[model samples]
Target chain A: MSFQPVKFYQTGTFTVGNRLLPPEERSVQAQTKRFNSINSGHRACQGCGEALGARYAVDAAMEAANGQLICANATGCLEVFSTPYPETSWQVPWIHSLFGNTAAVATGIAAALKVKQLKGERRDIRVVAQGGDGGTTDIGFGCLSGMFERNDDVLYICYDNGGYMNTGIQRSSATPPAARTATTLAVGDEPGNLFGQGKFVPAIAMAHEIPYVATATVADLRDLEAKVRRAMAIRGARYLHILVPCPLGWGTASHETIRIARLAKETGIFPVFEAEHGELKSVLAIRRPLPVEDYLKPQKRYAHLFAPKARLEVIARLQQLADRNIRRYGLLEGN
Target chain B: MLKQIEGSRAVAEAVALCRPEVICAYPISPQTHIVEALGEFVKDGTLAPCEFINVESEFAAMSVAIGSSAAGARTYTATASQGLLFMAEAVYNASGLGLPIVMTVANRAIGAPINIWNDHSDALSQRDSGWLQIFAETNQEALDLHIQAFRLAEELSLPIMVCMDGFILTHAYERVDMPTQAQVDAYLPKYEPRQVLDPAEPVSIGAMVGPEAFMEVRYLAHAKQMEALKLIPGYAAEFREVFGRDSGGLTHTYKADDAETMVVAMGSLLGTIKDVIDEMRAAGHKIGVLGITLFRPFPIAQVREALHGAQRVVVLEKSLAVGLGGILATNVRMALSALPIDVYTVVAGIGGRPITMRSLHALFREAERDDIDPVTFLDLNHDVVDKQLARERSTRRSGPAAEAILRDIGVVAAKVAQEVR
Candidate 1:
């Protein structure tokens, strides 16, 4: 086999597609025949990141599985908005069980498929479980961890939009420090969410030594699609944590969803990386490392840090945390 | 094949004969051995193509069953007491989604002081969860009901709980006529899921139903259970033809044709109650036993017809409603609400307290005389209860009622040690 150097385009920008890339190498969303697994007519709020993330992730998974895909969705914004009784936006076989059992449900589907395959009925049918932050890192955490620990044939995707957006912006374990949620109000001595609280589930998932673990943001559709495809290609348990920026929860404009997600990655606050068998494989190095303020300033959740005289110490603490992530993941190129 | 086996093992063998594609297991007392045997069967290739998942909790066990069941796999799991309560949410979800998943609730009492003995509290707690619940009176019945449960659940597209008393049946060894695989295959057909998650026929299941259709959806669930009330007997008859036994039905009567007093109960307590009824009959009392094999869908018409000929009815149940009286007795009252029958509620064997034949005989004799209280607690230690009540009345803080009672009975070592000191 001869080696071929494929030319890439718009590498520095958060663009998902380029005409220069071959059809085979192009992102699933950039293709005209992409499977809209989560079809249109959803009741998602304006600039709902979960909606975008679910569509991108599930469509890519559907493409990877060759349209043979079943989804077990947790009760959250994605489930409620996409499926409301007499109407549903799902174009694929989907089930919304409860708030916390999506992972176990997917495991069951995979187990069923395994038996079916053994009995020579079906072949290579895949299962993907999707959940929101509250459903993934909080209530659903036990089931999620159990799925991971069992190394069950499931691909669990967590659309981490910081907090519980559907339930009125309540604080969740994924809610970042100093982000104001309904429960973690912006008025206390330590305003907004506590610094030491909240969890980065991708790390916890990697700790399970699962086959694959990756983190993506909605800003980089190409990266998100690539991760989903890569996860689907592998067997056993895999996890993809996507940072979906919720405009309603973050108090940003509808159009700012993608931009905020981009800033989140560029600011080193959310390090984009992939792992296999508990070992770091790759990191999507920051193309233009911006200050953490660039990510926090646009969102009203963090408006408290900049208002009533600058809370320099709190801002510094957040910047230090981002710096720690950058240093830990080697997010800076040629570091 | 008549063989002496533990109830759990027999039930496990019965579940295997049904050819469950997925069996999720989480260890809880009285239900553990059943899953352990299932795990062995899967490991030893006795149950081929079956996936035995040792889940972390009962919640995951039931959730996995929901998934596999929805994916067109015949799924089964076993749980008890706190385990059932832990998986309560998924239990409701499984029934709501109308998945034909069968579960064995090794019935044990729910606890404040934590007792792991036999009772119906676990299964009765989920009476209204949309799943068809059937009580098994013996190890043979437990095995037979499980085989029938899979068929009934799949036909109705509903979940079914085969509730057998923990330890009493689950731990006891008894001679059971274990049916061959051919007999089971003849009775229970291969699982053909009514709705499945398939790429070819894509559909959204477990959708979020709002107020407009939520009521209708729930009513349809009720409609299915009512449908089950009609189908159960036919399946039981088929099972009898195939397995050569009369095990499951809405209710099984023992000498109740012309009886004046009908003592009704569910689960393994029926065995003791039947023994007591025979003794009472031998003593020239016109009392008989009506064992409720199927508890849910309440069997209103059957229960009414069974008890109508009697002058008075006594419902002996293993579960209590605490502030109210009896859970099963309440339903019994509903069944006889149209008639002018005196239905006495005898809440007995709570928290694994053994329901002895002696106590039951006396209770039935009192019931025959119409001299028993409307709601009676069989074999209750009134002394300990009165002491606890007096302590609660006199002291501002009763200091944990369960512990206080244990102390009153000198069951707790700390209190005994303090007394010794």
Candidate 2:
């Protein structure tokens, strides 16, 4: 619900959310009164998408929950950066357990709340489990699946940077094919990551058939914020997997993080869509989508393909993969 | 109500009395019955207003407990052997964050050979993991200790592991004086967590502390466990007042006042040790049995006071440090290092091996004459071991030693490599 239709003066100037919009219409991020859940003065990298995503998601959750949200964070870039011993960046009640137990911890929090609420206590306290790609799609998969299957009252948000970015940018099952990570080096015939290795976990979440599942990216902060708010609005097992770009890990310019993520959604590689009870609700339509090479060419992780050998064949295969996702999800409107 | 029941079922009943808000568990042998009974209780509405989560793994089990405990709910779970190790990281996380979650560790052997029977190796392996560790000597203690465990954990804001002998106490049918919920409620107060995950009074938990605060953070954890030493006996005193029974404490000594030699042990094995000590004392032997109910806090002061005039102390533990000697013996030696007593360690009941009364008789006789080795494996088949040692010395590529020994004894098939085993 944009204020663009009603107010013509603040059109491009009030790009997303601003003072021009009504208080109810403005996002939590738009208002200066928003609780900075993951506050400033943390050691997040320059233009870190996870940092941005966490801020947007947690603030939106806090707003939707009416300031009754606690977080369980997995050990990754977010946990490590936000808390470094004597100082902490977390403004809300937060917990950082082991690398992969965040989902279960969040489930436990929900259980505690349920037990307390059943006894006629306040029932508004909600729980969120947040993790990077490694913690979600790989190590924490079983717990996440269990949480979804149990329909635990939790909103699990996975900030997918496509690899084990926290552990020095290694290959995770979430790492896309033909992506160069430390473990999946660009030194082989099928250079970077081998095709058919990585997993698409949002579909896996849908297979469990929980309440809500959606995908958003850091490029569209408004969309990410909206999905988080919507997920928080639901009662049971909601998953919102946001594709966050890691500037350092992806070998892209710090400012290119949003641009890269935008390209990822536009190219139909990481399908921006929502599903409720395993049925597709809608897709964030891909507008004027370019080829996969247009998305891949910016990062140094894919510099090998551009120089000495313009591996058009590899780019073509990647395009085919994106095309497949587009066809499967009907990502282009009216398709 | 006193009734004969399986130790696991008894423990389940005792836990039910504590009125936990969240109970999560994964199925591991010997531990299965406890959770299964609790599951039935939840289903039947006997344990009402509780969340019984059948978690996927031991890791998730502890993780769930951590969350509930942090959210100020009395939480619980159970595991044995590999399951304990599987949740080892979360185990540390629970205590590190000082969540008052009580867990039952059905003591089972950790394995490469994968033994499922009773042993203290699993519980003892987590000694340094920052949880308060206690052992049970009988089904009654197993039942009573769990009730106290919840209070002790909540009071201290630390996780507690109540280790009971698996299959021995867990599977064995024994009479237990199970406390009523009224008694438990009157004794144990509502869980008021020292720190909780509440939106009204929000505080960051499980923060990533770096070097500056990491050591201090660990020191505080250590300090809390040390505080358990005083609170354990204090709780036991209050428990005796409430229930009219002598159950939990730092240590329990039987006929140890005027004894010259004393046997020190933990868990259900202490019952067997006490029985032999009783027979020996009746026959004019100056020996006694000291059962350690609280092991992780290691009861240094009480241990010293218990063995004050004793000339000799025998430390019998079921778990070994592998390459090093007895696990309990190491701690006992350190606890008694200030004294002039001679401490002997006899590693026993490994992989559920039966430590018979006959072996205890011979060992005590040898201990009486001062003929026992400094470190002895009780009733070990020395012939098979010596042969295996020689076979290993005579060759470079000696096969799997356990299988080799089994083959020699005709237990393993001749072509053991091809056998299913």
Which regions in candidate 1 have their CA more than 4 angstroms from the true location? A1-17, B411-421
CA lDDT of every candidate? 0.90, 0.89
Query: Where does candidate 2 chain B have its weakest 10-residue lDDT segment?
Result: B412-421
Q: Write the per-residue lDDT of candidate 1 for residues B272-317, one digit (tens) a residue.
A: 8888777878888888888899888889999888898889999998
Off by over 4 Å in 2: A1-23, A188-190, B393-398, B410-421
Question: Can you give the lDDT of residue B52 in candidate 1?
Answer: 97
lDDT (Cα, tens digit) per residue for candidate 2, span B137-171: 99999989999999999988889999999999999
Best by lDDT: 1
